[model samples]
Target: MSRLVACLVLLALPALAAEPAPRRPVHTYSIVARDPVTGELGVAVQSHWFSVGATVPWAEAGVGAVATQSFVDPSYGRLGLEMMRAGRSAQESLAGLLAADGAPGVRQVAMVDAQGRVAAHTGDRCIVAAGHVVGEGFSVQANMMERDTVWPAMAKAFREAKGDLAERMLAALEAAEAQGGDIRGRQSAALVVVSAKSTGRPWVDRRFDLRVDDHAQPLVELRRLLTLQRAYNAMNEGDLALERKDTDGALAAYGAAEKLVPDNAEMVFWHAISLVGVGRVDEAVPLLQRTYKADPRWRELVLRLPRAGLLPDDPKLLARLTGAKAVKK
Candidate 1:
C-alpha cells in the first residue's frame, strides 16, 4: 500500500490514555488454539492492562502456546514451552511450572500442546470472576472480569466461529468483551500464531504476530491490522508468482490484494508497474496516470526504473510512462 494509507491509519490513532501510575495488578481474557487442519497454533488476548501481551502470551512453533496471567509469572511462558519441547504434554508442562512456583494459588495459566491437548489452571487466589473454559483444541481464560460469564462466552464463540485460527481467536476475544471484559476497562491486545511443524528457522515458523500496545478500542484496531496483514500476504504471493514468471498467477494475486484495499495507491502503483513488466503497458497506463496525477513523485520513480533495468529502456516506453517529452536520441 502507499505510505499514505499507512500514514492515514497512524494519524487516526488516538492519543494514549494515561496508564497506571505504577505497574500494579492487571487482569485479562485470552485464548490459545490450534488449527486442526493447518496445525497452526495461536493466542489472542485483550486486557484493561497496558501492553498486556508483552508479558502474557508466548508460543513456539511445533511446541505449544501459553498464556500465564493473574499474578502473571512470565516464567510459565518460558518454562512451559521448554518442558513441552522436552516431550511433556500440555498438562505435564503446566503442572511442572506450577509445581516449581510457590505462588501457584495466585496465578492462572493455560497451555495447548502440539497435539491439541489442552491444560489450564485458575488459582483460587486470582481475583473474583477468574476462571477458564477448555474446549476441543482451545482454551479461554479470564480474571477480574466484569462478570463470570466472560470465559464461557469466549468458549462458545470459539466453538461457533468460522475462519482461520486468528479470526476464531479474535472472535473469542470479542465474545469475552461482549460478556463483560476486564472490570477495570480496555487497553492493549495482541495475537501470536505459529506453524505446527518445527522449521528450525524461528522467523519462518512464526506467523501473524500483531499488537495494539494501548488503545481505547484495542480489539477494533487489532482487526484493522489483521485486515492489512492479509493484503500484504497477497502482495507477497504476487511477488513470488512474478519471480516464477507466472503472469496469470501474479495478476490474480495483485488483484486480490487490490480488492482488499481498493484505495491503496502504493499497491496500485506496484500493480501497474507489474503490468508494464508483462508488456501490458496499455492496460497499465490508466493506473499509472491516476497514480502520477495524485503524486508526480511516482512518475519520477518510474522514470528511474529504466536506469535500474527494472523497466524497458526504450525511450518511447519511458516517455509514455512518465508523460515526459520524448528525448531526441
Candidate 2:
C-alpha cells in the first residue's frame, strides 16, 4: 500500500509542477465616449500586450464607440456595436450584454452612445486596483494597474484636456501612464474616432485613427502621428474648396495646412496648384518650377494638362504656367 501511494504521489507532483491552473487575465480596460459638440463617437485603448487594437476600440460612424478588454473575449466588441446599431442606448446595451456573459467576472468594458449616454464595467476577477470612472461624456477604466489612482488620473485628464476627441483620448492615456499604468508595462495603444456625416466611405470617415503596435513610448508616437494626420486633413479640405472655386476658402485652408507641415512636398505642390487656379500664376511659377525640378515627371504631366482639360489650351497660358519652352508651329 505504501509503495502504491508513493507512485501516485510522484505522478501528481509532476503534473502540478509542469502546468499550473490558468489564472484569470489581468491586463484589460476600455473607454467608450461621445463628443458632445460634434456627436462623434470615439474609442481608445492601451495594453501591456501586443495588438490591443484587435480586441479593443470599436466604433460605428453614427452610432457609438465601445472598448472591450481584460481577459478579452472579442465577442463584446462585435456585439456591442451590433446592439448600438439596433438602437439600444449605451447603458441598456452594456448591462444586458454583461449580465448574459458566462465569464462576466473576467471581462472589462466601456461604452457610450451618440447622445452621450455612457456605461462601464470592470469584472470582479480582474486584478486588484481595477475600477472605472464615468464622466459626463466619457469613461476611463483600467485594470492590473501599478497603483490605485490610475483610473482617476485618466478621468481628470479627459475632463481637463483641451482639444478634439482624439486629443482628449490621448490625454487620458497619458494621465494613466503618469499614475502608474499597466503594472507589467506598456506595448500597444490605439485611437479611433468616427464622424457624424456617415459618408459610407470608411477611409474618409475617420476623424482620427492611429495605432502603435509595439513601442517603448507608444502614446508619444501616437500624438505626433495625430498632428501629422490633422495637417493632411486640412490640406484635403483646402483642395476640396479649390475645386468649388472658393479661392478665399482654399487659400485659408491651404495656408493653415502648410503652416502645420511647411516642408511637405505634397503641401508645397498643392499650394502651387491652388495659386495657379486662382490666377496667381506669376506667384505660382517659382513653386511649380521647384516642384517640377525635384521630379521631372511633374513637368510631363503639366504639359498634358491642357489635353486633360485641367488647363486652358492657349500656348501663352501653358508656357507661363510650365516655364517651359513653347512648342513651335
Instruction: Name the top TM-score candidate.
Output: 1
Q: Residue 64's C-alpha lDDT in candidate 2? A: 83
Tell me the spans in candidate 2 whose CA falls farther than 4 Å from its real position.
Answer: 1-30, 197-204, 289-301, 313-329
- What digit string (tens of lDDT, one per residue) describes model 1 on residues 238-286? 8888778787777788878878887777778778878888889998888
lDDT by residue (tens digit), candidate 2, 1-329: 23433343343444434543233253854566788898888988888888777667888888788888777766566666766676777776777666556677887888887788888888898876799999998998989999989999888888888988888888888888888789898888889999865788988888888888889987887887888888889888987786787876877777677778776666666777677767888877777777776786776666776675555677877777677678431
* Clashing residue pairs for model 2: 28-70
Name the TM-score of candidate 2.
Answer: 0.82
What is residue 118's positional error in candidate 1, in angstroms?
0.5
Clashing residue pairs, candidate 1? 2-266
